[model samples]
Target: MIGALLVMIWLLVAMLLLLRRSQAVEVVPSGSPDEAQIAHHLLLDASPTPLVLVSGTTVRTMNRASRLLFASDDRILPPPSSLFDESATHLRHAGRNWRADRVEVGDRSVVALIDIEAEERTAEARASAEMIQVLGHEMLNGLVPIVSLAECGVAAAEAREGDSALLGEILTTLARRAEGLRRFTEAYRELARLPPPLRLTVSIEEMIDDLARLFASRWPGVHLSIDVQPGLCGEIDRDQMNQAIWALLQNAAEAVEQGGVPSGRIDIRATAGDDVLIIEVADNGPGIPPDCAHTIFRPFYTSKAGGSGIGLSLARQVVQAHGGVLTLLEPFPTTFRAQLPGAAALYGTGSVF
Candidate 1:
């Protein structure tokens, strides 16, 4: 998208240059508009970026993109001053963020609106990928040698004669811990290397039933319930979506266990809209701490002792890969919601952390 935008900008610049050259060499008839002017208008209408031409505060003309943006009536545009601040580069309009750029064209001012929200998300995802690569590289370098040495020590201790029991036991513990660390590192690496999901039409009710059964087997003490709309189905990566939902369920179960709730309960609900699917998991446990809320979704950020801290982050990544959003809703009962696009609305959405 950015590359296409850059190409459009270059084309606009070339058109402006041609217009200047035409004005310098030729003159059109007094009552008729020049060929350059006609071509310039055509280019403006063809541009993907919303372009508006205004004489002071009054909007003189706008392109198709601008008309769609502001929902203009019969090609009539709203006053520029009302839509955006002339001095501000960033503005929120029509429920989206935009980077506004103004250019002077003779007496009229041309305002170009560039949607920056998607660009910002792309930048954030890039930063996360870089961070994961660097951390994984550094940690694995140190962990691999430690794991190998621990295994060698364990073997050596077991082979030694007389009073080797204590040494062997200590070496075995070290080897186990080191191996666990290696597995943890590999899990995170897999998260960083997650591939695009393979989508399928899945039954929401059956999926919820599976999750409920799994949760019951894992935490028999905690009660689990499901409330899915009948015939609720969506086009999604079934395995990825299941993993994401399981993470939420496991997180809730752990929270309930940690809080020592006498009567723990978890509810999984699924509802469908015209072009979206909403899945929510709520638990009656000691909710997330106020201070930890911001960093909870961050990879490897955990408050629990010996926690892998990969569940929530992995769940979020999977949902995002499926062109969806996984969010922790605020307040009590500790609900996590995943909003996903249905088949009709599945195009153009990209994955992000």
Candidate 2:
């Protein structure tokens, strides 16, 4: 009877000890609610897209990017206007609606504004407006060409001289000029038709290798260096992402191709965090000009001479379409970083994206 009582007493003491340890646990284990929060810390810090958490009118949290975007938080917030705006500040855009509002949250300005359905809509409108202005430019490029040639051809025909030479020269020049227009229009089609990307579970390492191989093959003169993490891949479109990386590589190659810098170094890196992943491409070439830095991704903006200026913009579009982000960090040697959410978080968590 005493032994039995002692066993019961030991069991009771062990139960109390376990209860105390349970209370001391900081976060739930894997598959628990708190586990997800801990896993997403890096994403919360470095995500390129802005995120604002609100509970009825009280601002709960704003990430680093949201803070930088708003400029200042003290500015008054516009009243709620539309579901997209969620604010009442409606500035008449004449053709479209535009609004801006600011709120303060922990030393940051979170400006909540209208969420547009498409960037292509804006790009197409801008491209069309540019074409209207460039019509004269195109005419000038071609119109001056054939008059002299045609007149010479007629003179040759009257003199019983061979008209073939004059006619061929004029025809060749016209054909070349026409081909230029066709190529330009083709580029426009590529920009305007920014096709919907296919999303898949991609290992980040594989993309890095593929991009590296592509650049290595194309730019054999420039040295390519990749420091991507082997297992740190995420969900992204393989073809479009390959194209984006190719654009970045070309941009970097341009910066260094000239005779200024000794040996150009193109560094491609991928770092994966709990819930976020960042792929960075940095070049030791001449950094982007300060004047053109901010507008680099804007359509029709390019620092290069005779460059069509849509590559970076298209890259940005692709990243945005994947619910990811691409940004330029310009100081000395410029760094272009692409930030994307891990497939697991974006797919599993409701708040991800």
Which one is best on TM-score? Answer: 1
- Candidate 1 global CA lDDT score: 0.79
Predictions in order: lDDT: 0.79, 0.68
Model 2: residues with Cα > 4 Å off, grouped in runs? 1-163, 343-353
Residue 339, model 1, lDDT: 93
C-alpha displacement of 106 in model 1, angstroms? Answer: 24
In model 2, residue pairs whose N, Cα or C atoms come closer than 3 Å (at least 3 residues apart or on different chains), thus clashing, are: 79-87, 79-88, 80-87, 80-88, 81-87, 81-88, 204-233
